[model samples]
Structure formats: C-alpha cells, structure tokens
Target: MTDISPILEFLPCPTPEAWIEEARKPENLAVILVDHANNELKAAQSAMAIMSRYRTGKFGQNRGTSHSNEEKVGLQLKTDDQLSLLNKMSRLAREELRHYEQVLAIMARRDIPYVHLGAGRYAGQLSTAIRTFEPFRLVDTLIMGAFIEARSCERFAALSPWLDDELKKFYLSLLKSESRHFQDYLTLAEAINGASVADRVAIFAGIEQDAIESRDHHFCFHSGVPA
Candidate 1:
C-alpha cells in the first residue's frame, strides 16, 4: 500500500457530536445535491477521456478496459501513447464514479435534485496552463490529481462537524481513500519519469496552496475561501 500518512495528517475532521448536529440540518440537502452532481460529472469526464483515448475499432467490435456505468461514447485517440494515457485515466475514472454513486445514494435518500458546482480554479488552471510535453503533462496531471484529492480530504474533514451522522461517516470514510489516491498519483508520476518529481511537486504545491487560500467568487469541493 502507498504510504499516505503525511496526507492523513492534513485531514481536518471535527468531533462526532458536532458532526451529527450539522448533518440533521435540512438546509445541507442543497450542498449534498451539488456535491453528488460534481462527483458524477468528474467521473463521466474521466471515463470519456479513457474511451476517447483507449477504445479500439468500432464500439461493438472492441470493448474498453474500464467497466464503468458511464458508456464508452467514442474512441477518438490517434496514437498508442493516447491509449496508454487513457488506461491510466481509467483507474481515476472508476474511483470517481464510485464517489459519485456514493453521493448519489445520499442525495436520493434526501430527495434532493443533483446540481453540479462549477469547476474550481484548480482544474481550470490545469486546462489552460498545462505544458505540451507528454512527460511533463503526465507529471503535472499526477501532481494535480494529488492536490485535488488532498484538498477534498481536507474539506471533508473540515466540514464534518457541520454535517449529519450519515454524511459525516461517509466523509470520514473518504479520508483514507482520498489520501491513497493522492499517493497513487504521485507515485505514478515518479515511476513514469524515472526522475525526481520533487521540484514539480513543490511548484504545484505552491500553486495548490495559493488556490486553497485565495478568496473565491464561488465554492466547490476544491474552491478556496468563499469571497
């Protein structure tokens, strides 16, 4: 197993008593709606990335490695490099889909309509600022995944006190998995490059920290302080 102890230390869980009190509040159903929808969208995107890059031939002729509920819409990749990249992306997509389902279950029980929050600066910046080199892009993507998962863990822990019992339990359960996901991404980056990713990690860490600290006009799973 990947050693994610360091990231675990960063979790900000609250006391149980406080968590239950917050979870029972009816207003939180809205937050749950947005949270679950965001998970669903992220999962769908990941799966789409995999399908477009890894699937072969016609859809009926060839099947994909990923077996997610999300359909493999199309295979648009032009090279083996893309297939390999999508294979890795498949792993991420699976986990994200699981997260989506988990949140959806909660929302269904609460009778809330799922509504996704907009992309935070973290993911948006990656789309706009990522390097063109494949190797560099891989490293950057891994680092970005790590940061996103870590931030999610941090927020889950932070928001626990304000959540209800079931929700709090779900969030607490997420901490370990999210921490491991962060480590997995970092490890893959190092394994692929066979070079030190420290400088890259530091560079992105600085950006991630800034993103988390800055005031934001909107709030999402990875958004910074609300404006």
Candidate 2:
C-alpha cells in the first residue's frame, strides 16, 4: 500500500485530536463499530444513487407527471464519460458493501449487537451547502463525497493505533481503498466540471472542518468532539 502520510496532506481537513481521544475510549468501541458498519452501507448506497441519477439520468424527473414513465424507461448509458463514471461507481459501491460486511463480521465475533441508530449531523450539515442547480449541484456533491471519504480515511488512521490487534489490522487494511475512494470522487468531480474544483473544495473543507471540530451531543463513527 502507498504511504498514507502524503495522502493525509491532500485532505482539506485533518481528524480532530479531541475526536480521536474520545473515540479511543474503550467504552465507545461498540457504538463506533456499529456506526462504522452503517456508514459503509450508507456510503455504498450514496454512490449507487449517484450512478442512478447522473449516469442514468433518472433522478430529476417528476414522479407524478406524465413524463415520469418515459423517464424511467429512458435510462440508458449514453456517453463514454457516463460509462466510465458508472463503472467506477459500481466498483466503489461493491467495495463499500464488502466493507460493511467485514465490519459486521467483526461485530459478531466481538458479540456486539447490531442495532439501528440515528446518524450524526455531520453529513446533513455539510449537505446543506450543496447548490440546487444542475452541473454545479453535481460538482458540489462529488466534492462532498471526496471530503467524506477523506475524513473517514483520516479517522481510521487516527483510531487504528488505539484499537485492539484485530481492529488495528482491519482499519489499516481499509486505508488503501478509502484513499482511492477519495481520489475517485475528486477525479469525477473535476471531469464532470471540466475545470478545477479547488474553490468548491475549499468551501466544503471549511464546512467539514467545523463539523469535525465542533462539540456534538452524541458519539458515532463520524461524530465530532464528544459533548
């Protein structure tokens, strides 16, 4: 695997030390593991949704309108770029799902019950900044994806040293794919925009940093500093 030190420098924000210290507490391990499993599934779902919406062009059509049926039937891979995007997203979705399964297996071995829990406000708060327009919205979304994956990678690296042997190995193993996921999202965003995404990236970087550094009422895999 490639050295993560260089990749960490590319991230817009670093994982907060306060959050890492809170996460290292043994009492929070179960909740963190469970939430990490859910996060993997959610990440896969989000990527799949992007493929469906953009590559297939099926997302924006009004369901109650007369054109809804036509839109649904019109889903087809149109361009080389779309095809490429579809392929990348499909692979990412599969990998993320596999990670979800891996997390579940670890949870089972540790006898940590998988229970449904509400997600933290980190994602929701970042999503609020997404533009409501077409290509711009897509660009913003992809940049947000990059930030999310980058942060996940950062957190995994930060927490790995503090975890038990099994988890430390697992998190270290995940670093490569998580790093690639961040790169893929950024690449797609730049390709789709046909321009540098640096400004938008900077905008979301501030948002992501605030979400990570601020105090939170609950602790989860991606939550900020513990309250």
Candidate 3:
C-alpha cells in the first residue's frame, strides 16, 4: 500500500466511521458503486475545466495586433506556462477517466447498473466560496482539487480493509496515483499563485473540515458524516 501519511496530514479531518459503516451496508452497495463511478467522471470533468482556463490562444494577442518587445516576451512566457498546465490537466483527466472505466467495469460485474445521482453539498460549498477574481480564482480551484483528491485517497485507504479482494486492490492502487495527483494540484497552485498559499490553505482546510464533519443526509463518495 502507498504511504498516504502526506495525504492524511493534508486533510483536516478523517472520514467519519459512521459513514464507512453505512457505506459497507449491502443495501447501499449499488448506490455506492454507482456514485463512485460518477465521482470518477466528475473528477475527469474538473481536470478538463482547469485545462480550459489555460487554453493556448487566450495567452496571446488578438490576430494582427501589435505588441512591444516586452509584451511579446510576456506573451511567449504565458503561452509556455499555458502549454505546461494544459499537458498536466490532460494527463490528469485521462487518468481519471481510466479510473472511471475501471469502476464501471466493477459495477457491471456486480450487475449494478449506472444511475443518476445529485451532487452532494461538499463540492458545491467549496466551489461557491472560491474568490471570484483573477489568479485567486484559479488558485482556489487548484487548491480545491488537491483537497478533493487527497480526501478521495484517504477514503479509499479507510475503506480498503473492509472491501472485497478486487475492490481492495483497486482502491489501493488508486491511492498512489491519486495522491500524486493531489500533490500535482498543490504544486501547480503554488506555482501559478507565485506566493505561499499557506493562508488560503488554512482557510480552505477549515471549510473542508466543516464539510466533512457536518451532518449530511446525502450519501456520496465525498459526503460528510452520515446523518
């Protein structure tokens, strides 16, 4: 198993035992599997959304537009940065979709048909709280991505011991990659912000802790303590 101490340390609160127990119930199995698959898809979508922010042409001047030497240099630098971010998000998105495919395969073997589920409050709360300004917006989004990935990894680790052999192995495998994805997001956020994110991290940590510890009737991969 991957050493996920870093992921655990990054998270403000551990997933509640009550949630795990409720998740383990046979009655919830189908919902769990289906929701989990949905989460993977959502993860992929989030990565793409980040990539959307870095679209290449957006970094350059409009067609037939003139630029001073300094502006030209700035455009080149921004384009390079955009390309780098675009590459990272592309890989992250692809990996998430692969995980989605794996989950769907497992669900199929178990005869659990995919079903629609609503978003839980956890993501909406964090997203709505993000600062709606340049740089800060992207920074908060990346930070949010890191926390979500870290929590997912932690949850997988927490649930592994109780799962069947196939799921146990699959969840364990995800921790290594997903935890790395967590780190990737943090590194990118700090790089893009060009400053220490300690303050923002602390604030978001509190929000995440509240989201995790609050009583939530919603049952999903990222839900808080089961109500």
Top lDDT prediction, candidate number = 3
Which one wins on TM-score?
3
Clash-forming residue pairs, model 3: none
Deviation in Å, model 3, residue 198 alpha carbon: 1.0
Query: Per-residue error at 111 for model 3, in Å?
Result: 0.3
Candidate lDDT values, in order: 0.59, 0.82, 0.83
Q: Write the per-residue lDDT of candidate 1 for residues 102-169, one digit (tens) a residue.
A: 88778789777766455667577544434444445545766767666776666567666667788778
Better of 2 and 3 by TM-score: 3
Q: Total clashing residue pairs per candidate?
A: 2, 0, 0
For model 3, where is the 10-residue window of minimal lDDT?
69-78
Clashing pairs in 1: 23-163, 23-164
Q: What is the TM-score (0 to 1) of candidate 1?
A: 0.70
RMSD values, in order shown = 9.5, 4.9, 4.7
Ranking by lDDT: 3, 2, 1
Error of 3 at 83 (Å): 2.7
Which candidate would rank higher by lDDT, 1 or 3? 3
Please report, as a residue range, the 10-residue window in candidate 1 with the lowest summed lDDT.
68-77
